[model samples]
Target: MSEWVDVHFQALETCGKRARSAANMLTVEDVFQDSSAKKPADAAQASMFGDLSHSGALAGKVNDVWSALKEELGTGRSRLQGVEKAIDQVETNLRKATKAATV
Candidate 1:
């Protein structure tokens, strides 16, 4: 039983690490778009499953790390949306500033 627990714990850790890495990649990709238009929030949602390999383990939540990772991803997605919105606002302000300067 102990060995089995250890195995599952290691698996959970590995999943968390992979999820974190994928989250990083998604973040970079989301920000690196060719166009300046804001992406949908669902675009961020699309990243949440990139690293998930074990549906059974995720459903079990035996170690509770899976839940934590889900929360982390959710927070990361929200942060990405906020950053995108801020970027749009900044770009708009810059355009206005440039126009005013030209005037």
Candidate 2:
């Protein structure tokens, strides 16, 4: 009965590791720098719409996207933590059940 539990625990460990890796893939600094937004946004606005206004609007939009991505990544990381905790509980219960059966 507990053989499948061992396999499931290993699978959860792998899934949690992959989720943590995905979560670390993005950061706030990876999006915007400390300098004025106009320079960074200039490249984007120029490519999208030639000679567009460097009014920082495009920068705000880009930042919004990155912020949302980072938030989602944070959620994913938290979920992985939850999965690890679940594995712990499952392992504990399986051990208890086995011990009780032998008794």
lDDT of each: 0.54, 0.62
Q: Pick the candidate with the highest lDDT.
A: 2
Question: Which stretches of model 1 miss by more than 4 angstroms?
Answer: 1-63
Query: Between which residue pairs do clashes occur in model 1?
Result: none
Determine the C-alpha RMSD for candidate 1 after optimal superposition of all C-alphas: 23.0
Tens digits of per-residue lDDT, candidate 2, 30-101, equal 434554552233333334644568746775687677667768767766776676667667667767886788
TM-score of each: 0.41, 0.54
